[model samples]
Target: MPDQHSTLRAQRRAETQRLIQAHAVRLFTERGYDATTVTDVAEAAGVSPMTVYRHFPTKEDLVLIDRHGALVAERIAASPAERPLVGRIGGALIDSVAALTGGGHGDDLTADERFLLARLQLMISTPALRAKHLDNHYALQQAIVDALGDDATDPDAAFHVRAAASACLAALHTALVRWAEDDGRTELPELVTKALAAAFGERIVDTPR
Candidate 1:
């Protein structure tokens, strides 16, 4: 019973954190990240400024640390070891996108998904946010390398895994930058799928303009 209660409490805490982040992103998009304040996010989220700080120490964190990246990392870690590493990474990215945006169809996004897309736009367009995102992208690659469980002492394995992770991240970053450039009219999932295919040496029949 105590364990069950603890689980419930943790779940509630996580939900509250998501709520805080979602509201913070919305405010950042609506009012501009520079003009928005933590107090404003707190009020929007119906929490105290201290609580907002507890979840996100800085305004930049509200944009940098996202659940989708963690989910994609977990998917990559869970991929079968026998599979080709780059292909597995690509599949994991698609799976994560489907999970985040309900199949990444882009036909009719849910309210939350729409807001998340908006948040991505804001992050890519804003210089400060873009810098933080690049830092986070490197951190994410390190995380993927760690998840791959390559022996740090084995120079060959370490180099191979690092190279693979770097390429995967590069493809993802390229797709995102292009998507943002097009004003997000193209479905992100489609862009990611195409970019990964090209990265793995598949010929592209249609390129994003």
Candidate 2:
């Protein structure tokens, strides 16, 4: 079973975040990302502008977060012990895409398939959102560390876990971005599948399992 607390936290986070993104994206699409103010989105979402600041400290965070990040965090957290680590990650990415596109694992990327793709493009085009995206990658990796077993007898082993987690996340991000450029107009599964293979292949080949 999934950790209810984690699932609830992620649900709340994505709900608040998606609400913010939906509004911000509308404003940005209408007035442009650079032209629109945080106040604009806050007004649209019906929250006080300051309440908007609380949920999104920076305007860019509104663009940076979407349903996908929260889903990825939750999927990895819920993965079972019997699942291969790389398999868990690849599965999580696929699940996150389902949350994004309302589809299955092998579906190719959908171009602005919905507001989700638009939000993704917005983040890519904006430098601030790009940086927040990087921060999120590391944050998710930390959450993965906690999930794996925080009770480490060997401190060095913990560091190794974090390092491996970071590398895996970095690859996922790179693969996703490249997939975006293809605009979901090209073969999407190949890009992500290759990334999955690269990430888990090295470790799997060396491990006994």
- Top candidate when judged by lDDT against the true structure: 1
Per-residue lDDT tens digits for candidate 1, residues 104-140, read: 3254666655766777788887889988887787787
Q: Give model 2's TM-score versus the native structure.
A: 0.71
TM-score on alpha carbons, each prediction: 0.86, 0.71
Off by over 4 Å in 1: 104-107, 150-153, 203-209
Per-residue accuracy of model 2 over 1-209 as CA lDDT, tens digit each: 47998999889866776687788987886787889998889888887888788888888777765445567768767766576665665666655655556332225434335465566667788777777777777777766666667422368867776776676676667767775665554344445556766767745423332
Candidate lDDT values, in order? 0.75, 0.66
Ten contiguous residues minimizing lDDT sum, candidate 2: 103-112
RMSD of 1: 4.0
Report the Cα lDDT for candidate 1.
0.75
